[model samples]
Target: MTKVNVIGAGLAGCEAAWALARYGIGVRLFEMKPKKFSPAHKYGGFAELVCSNSLKAARLESAAGLLKTEMEMLGSLTVPCAKANSVEAGGALAVDRERFSDSVTEKIRNCELIEVIEQEVTELPEGVTIIATGPLTSGALAEEIRKLCGEGLSFYDAAAPIVTYESLDMEKVFFASRYDRGDADYINCPMDKEEYLAFYRALIGAERVQLKDFETHPFSVYEGCMPIEELASRGEDTMRFGPMKPVGITDKRTGRRPYAVVQLRRENREATLFNLVGFQTNLKFGEQKRVFSMIPGLENAEFMRFGVMHRNTFINSPVLLNADFSMREHPDIYFAGQMTGVEGYMESAASGIIAGTAAARRLLGLEPIQLPKDTMTGALCAYISDPFNDGKFQPMGANMGILPDIGERIKDKKEKYGVYARRAVDSLQRELDRIGCNSNS
Candidate 1:
C-alpha cells in the first residue's frame, strides 16, 4: 500500500490525512503539541482554531458560505465536524472551540489508515509528503519551508478579541443582520457620531504590542484580515466605511441608522462568548480593554480572549505549486492551508482536500481531478497557481470578485451572488462525476 507523510495536525493537515485515508492510502500524520506550542496556540489537539470560532456568514450567496458548501460536497472532514458542534450565531456557523477540536482529534485518531505521530518536524521528509503547518508555523520547520519557497513568505497576521456575552449591556445593543437579510444573529452596538469619533480617537492612540527584533520583518497586511486600528488610522471615517459602517442596519430605539456600529458575533454555540467582527488587532491587552470598552455596549465587557498579532507564513504558490497543490519542481511534494495562500479556515481545508486527493490519485495512477473553474474551490486553486499571478500574488480568500462575472448584468447584489453560488455547485457536481469521485465518500 502507498503511504504518505502529512506534516502538521492543523485543519489542513488533518483534512489532508483524512482525505488520503479515505482513499485507502496510508498516512503518517505529524503534530507538535503538548511537547511544543506556537506563541498563538494553547490547545494540544489537532485542528485547533487559534483565531475566531465563527466560520463567517452561512448563507449560500456569501463567499465564505459558498466555499464551505463546496467543501461539504468534497467529503470534507472539518465542515461536518464543525456542523455537528455548531452554536447559534444568527445565520453564521459558530462552534464550541474545545468540542470542535476534540471531535476532529477523535475522528483522526480512530482512522486506522492514519497513524498520528506526535513530534516536531524540522526537516522536510523524503518521499510523498503534504505540508500543511498553517500560518503560525515555527522554529526549524519554518526555516525549512522558507528554504524551499525562497523569499515568498509573510510573517504578520492578526486575530480579533472575544468577550463574555454576560458582560455586554443588552440595553445598549440589539441583535440584527444588515438589511434584515438573514437571521438576527449579530449583536449591534450602535454609536452616534460623537461616540464614534471618541472611540475612533482612543483606538488610533492606543498603544500596540511591540514585536521582537527577530520577529520584525517587513509585512504587507492581507486585506481580508486587516487590523482594526490600522484600518482606523487610514482616516477618520475609514473604519465606518469598513467594519463599522452602518449602512443597512437601523437602531430599533431610534428607528434610524446610527453613525456607526460595532458588531459582535457569537464565538460558540452557547452564545456566551462573542467576538468583535472584523476587529483584528495588535494592541496591548490593557489598551485593547481600555479602548474597546469605548464602544456602546462593550463599556464593561469581560474579555475571554484578547485580540493578538502573530507571524503568518505563506509561499508564492503561483511559482511553486500546480492548481492541484502539487509542487512545480517535485510532483511528490504538495502544500496546503494558508501556506499555499488560501486564506480562510474553509479555504485552507479545501486546499488540503484537493492536495490529499491529488496525491492519492497520483500514487494510485489515476487521472487528475479537473475541478471546474466556475467552482469556488476551483477558482481558489486557479488563483494560487496561475503563473501570471507570480509577481503580484497575495493571499486570497473566497469572494465573488475572483469568479468570472456573469456576462449579463444583475442590479440586485444578492440575486447576482445567488446565481454565482448555484452555477458553482452545478459545475462542481459535473466535475466530480467526470473524475468518478463520490461527494459522499
Candidate 2:
C-alpha cells in the first residue's frame, strides 16, 4: 500500500485522511496541538471549531443543505459526526463542538489505515502529501507553504468572539432559534426600534484596532459572520437584514419581532460558552466592550473570546491546481482547505475528500475521480479552477450561485431551489456511475 501524509487534523485534514484511508491508502495525520497551539485553540482536541458550531443548513432546498447532501452521498464522516452531536437550530445543522471533535478523533483513531501524529510539521515531505493546515497555520509552516505556492500566500485572518454562557443577562434574553423551529438552542437579545438605532450608532462610531502597513495587504470578512462595526458602517438597517433580522424571532415581551435582535448560540456541549451569532469583529478590545454592551441583553455580557482578524492565505487555485487539488507545478503535492480557496467547513472537507481520493488513486494506479459539475462538490472544484478572476476572485462558498442558473427562472424561491437541487443530484449520480461507483453495488 502507498503512504500518504496529511497535515493538520482540523476538519479538512481529518476528512482528507479518512477519505484516503477508505481508498486503502495508509495516511499519517498531523495535528499541532498539545505539542503546539494556535492563538484561537484552547482545547487539545483535533478538528476544534474556532468559530460557530452551526454547519450552515441541512435543508435540501438551501444551497448549504444541498452541498451537505452531496457530501453524504460521497460518504462523509463530518456529516454523520455532526448528526450524532447536533443541536437543533431551525433548518441549520449545529453541533456540540466538543462532541463533534471527539467523534472525528475517535473515527480517525479507529481506522486501521490511519496513523495520528500529534506533532507540528514545519515543512512538507517530498512524496505525495496534502496540506490542510487551515487558516491558523503556524508562521514557520505558513512560510514553507508560501515557498511552495510561489507568490500566492496570505497570513492575516480574523475569527469571531465567543462568550461564556454565564455572562449573558438571561433575564433580558429569551431562548429560541429562528422561527421557533428546532431546539431552542439560541439566545436572542431583542431590541426595540429606538434601542436598535442607538446600538447601531455606537457600533459605527466604535474605535477599531489599527494594523501596521494596512494598505499593502487586503482582508475580506467572512459573510456569514460580519464584524458588528463593519455591518454598522454599511447602513443602520444592514444589521436588521443580516444578523439582527427580526423575521422569525418573536419577542415575548412585545408579542412581535423586535426591531432588531442579537443572537447568541451555545458553543460547546457544556453550554457554559456562547458565541455572538454574527459578531465577528476587528474592534479594539475596549471598543468591543463599549459598543457590544449597547445591545439590550448584553449590558453586562462577559466575553470569553474577542473577535480578531488575520490575513487569509490562498493560492489562485484555477492557475495553480487541477480539480484534484494537486498543483500543476508539482503533482507530488496537494493543497486542501482554505489555502485552496474553498471557504467554509463543508467546502473545505469536500476539497480534502477529492484531493485525498485523487492521491490514493495515483498511488493505487487507479484513475482520479472527477466529480460531475452538477454536484456541489464538482461545482466548487470548477469555481476554484475556473482561472477567470474577471477583475475579482474572492474565495467562494458552495451556493446555488455557483450552479449554472436554470434556463427557466421559477418564481417561487423554494421550488426553484428544489429543481436545481434535483438536477444537481441526478447529474451527480450519473457522474458517479461513469466513475464506476454504484449507489448500492
Candidate 3:
C-alpha cells in the first residue's frame, strides 16, 4: 500500500491522516510546530485553534450545525473530540483550546498507521500528498505553492454578507441595473432619506468582532476593501456618495429616484443567493443581521454568510483544484483547509475528510465517493471548485444558501432550515450506503 504524506498538523491535516489511516493506508503526518510556528500559532500541539473557540450553533437547522452533522456521519475525528472537550457556550460547541489540541495529538500519536514528522516541508513531496497548511501559509512553502499554481490571488477578507433571494421582500425590492444600461442583474433596495440615515447610524454603532492577534497583520483599509461601517463613519453623506449612491437608479414603487439604494448582486449562476454590493463589513454576525436587515426589502432577510475581516492567504481553488480537493493537473496532490478557500474550522476538517478518502479510494483501486450537491459537505466542495466562481472566488464557509432550493416554500424559518438540514443528511447517507462505506464509518 502507498503511504500518504499529510502536511501540517492542523484540523485538516489530522482529519486527512485519520481518514487515510481508517482505510488501512499508512500516513506520514508533518508538523513544523515545536521547531517552527506560523505567526498565528502559539501552542506546541496538533490542531491548535487560534481563532474563536466556538464551533458555532449545535442545532441541526443552522448551517454550521448541518456541516458538523455531515462530518460526523463521514467518521470525523474532530467533531467527537470537540464535543468531549466542550465548554458551556450556550448553543455553540466551544472547546478548551489546549485540551482539544492535546486530545488530537494523543490520538494521532497512538494511531499505529500514522507517523508524525516535526519538520517544515520546503518542497512538495513526490507521490500522493495532501496539503492542509492553512490560510496563513508563509515562507518557503508558500513560494513553492505560488510557483506550482501561479501567483495566488487574495481577497483581504473584506467579503460582503450574502443573503438568500427568497428571504428578500420582493414587494419592497425591484430588479434593475444602474441606468438600465445592463441587464436587470442587480436586486435594488431603494431607501428613503430617513431610512438611509437610520441604517447608516445603526451600522456605525453595530458591534464588531475584534481581530485576534493572528488577524491583526498590518491590515489597513483603502477604497477597495473598506468596511461599510468604516465608509459610513467617515461622514453622514460618505455612504451616500459611495456604495449607497442612488444617482442612476429610480425606485419603481415611487416612480422616482430614492435617497439611496443598496444593490444585491447575484452570487451564483442560479441567483438563489445574492451578495451585498460594496457592503463589506467586519461587524459581528448578530450585529450584521440586525443592522443589514434595516435596508428596504431586507427586513426579513436571511443571511447565508456574514462579512468577516482577516488577513488570510488562500489559493484560488476554483481555478486549480477539483471538487474532490485534488489538483486538476495533478490528481495525486491535494489541498485542504482554509488555504483551499473553505472557511471556518469544521469546513476545513470536512475538506480533509473528503480529500483523504478520495486519495485512499484511488490507492485502493476503488471509485471515489461522489457526495451529492444537496448535502452541506458536497455543496461546499462544489462551491470552491465550481468554474463559475473562478475569477471572483472567495472563501466560503458552510451555508444553507449554497444548497439547492427545496423547491417548495415553507413560511417558518426554522421549518425551512429543518427541511434543508434533513435533506442534506438523507442525501449524504444514501451516497455512503450506496458506496458501502457505512461499515468502516
- Top model by TM-score, which number? 3
Residue range 45-117, candidate 1, lDDT tens digits: 8889876899888999988899999998888999999999999999899999999999999999999999999
Q: Which numbered prediction scores highest in lDDT against the true structure?
A: 3
What's the residue-level lDDT of 183 in candidate 3? 92
TM-score of every model versus the real structure: 0.69, 0.68, 0.95
What's the lDDT for all of these models? 0.87, 0.79, 0.90
Residue pairs of candidate 2 with colliding backbone atoms: 154-313, 155-311, 156-310, 156-311, 157-310, 157-311, 158-309, 158-310
lDDT of 3 at 181: 93
Which 10-residue window of candidate 3 scores lowest in summed lDDT?
213-222
Per model, how many backbone clashes are there?
2, 8, 0
Error of 3 at 224 (Å): 1.2
Stronger candidate by TM-score (1 vs 3): 3
The local lDDT score (0 to 100) that residue 210 gets in candidate 3 is 83
Tell how far residue 3 is off in model 3, in angstroms.
1.7
C-alpha positional error of residue 213 in candidate 3 after TM-score superposition, expressed in Å: 5.0
